[model samples]
Target: MKKSKRKLAAIAAGTVAAPLVAIIPATSAWAHGYVSAPMSRQAQCAAGVVQCGGVKYEPQSVEGPKGQRTCSGGSRFTELNDDSKGWKVTDVGQTMTVTWTFTARHRTTNYEYYVGGRKIADISGNNQQPPQTISHQVNFGGLSGHQKVLAIWNIADTGNAFYACIDVNVK
Candidate 1:
């Protein structure tokens, strides 16, 4: 009789404590916080399919202030708003890669790549090729060891293009 009561109590305690135990670790991991990249400058093309797009480095990090933000750190606030094509940035800690893809319909367009506001690679005039991919790996160049990279794209033309951005941590 006494054993039965004790067993029931133990079961009830386990059921209540198990959930609490699981939740604590999850909450801690969630609170670790996230960081974001700097910034990239972008603009539409004036003549050809491609235009000048520079990288902008925000000298300071952005504190959350108060509320939680979907993005954190000094990420890129500049972007290339073109519905035709796609632009993406992949940050691999040591090296950051930015990729731009466009269709032949977007010929005469130009794209400029930069690291820390310094022009790194400039691709001009689409070769009138079919939908393709163009990518460049940028060396942050004596950065602060590990840099949160930000990439920007400028759709200088009105044609069609696909764009995406990704961040990869090498360390």
Candidate 2:
């Protein structure tokens, strides 16, 4: 009958759309993450050490394509990378540990720390899904005075990474 044919067509359409609806959320929401300890740029914003707009509300969202080498998360959150706002320098020794906080864990690729555009530390996450908190210990060597350290968190299965710029005074 005509009703049977219409029902079959509707079932086919629903089957096709189900995969798309499920894939959309599985990719986006689980992608958010950010560094917390040692006070990253977003952490400063969230803590009111610096003034920020949307990033203060959603620190985990300051992410962009891996290897970009800058913050702001690709313009939607440019305030994440803004330096004129002035951040409080965290007092750090020659070696310090930085931590990342995530609501949903993902298989991590690696963690990179850069000072003055030079890579000072690289830690492997080994495609392991860490706990809610991830930490990396970095050595700044003889570097002193005020400096900005850019930290990148690359995800294993995705080409995206979360970026955080930490201001520190190496002591």
Best by lDDT: 2
Worst 10 residues of 1 by lDDT: 30-39
lDDT (CA) for every model shown? 0.36, 0.85
Per residue, candidate 2 scores C-alpha lDDT tens digits across 1-171 of 999999999999999999999999877656667889888888889888888898888888877888878876474888776688888789999988999999667788988899988999999989988788977889998999888999888889788888888889999
Cα lDDT tens digits, model 1, 1-171, are 999999999999999999999998654432111112322212122122334233222211211222222122222422333323332323355555554433222333444433334555555545443245455665645553332233333233332222222233344
TM-score computed on alpha carbons, candidate 2: 0.85
**Could you tell me the lDDT of residue 157 within candidate 2?**
78
What is candidate 2's CA lDDT for residue 126?
92
**Span of 10 residues, lowest total lDDT, candidate 2:** 25-34
Candidate 2, which segments miss by more than 4 Å at Cα? 1-20, 23-25, 73-75
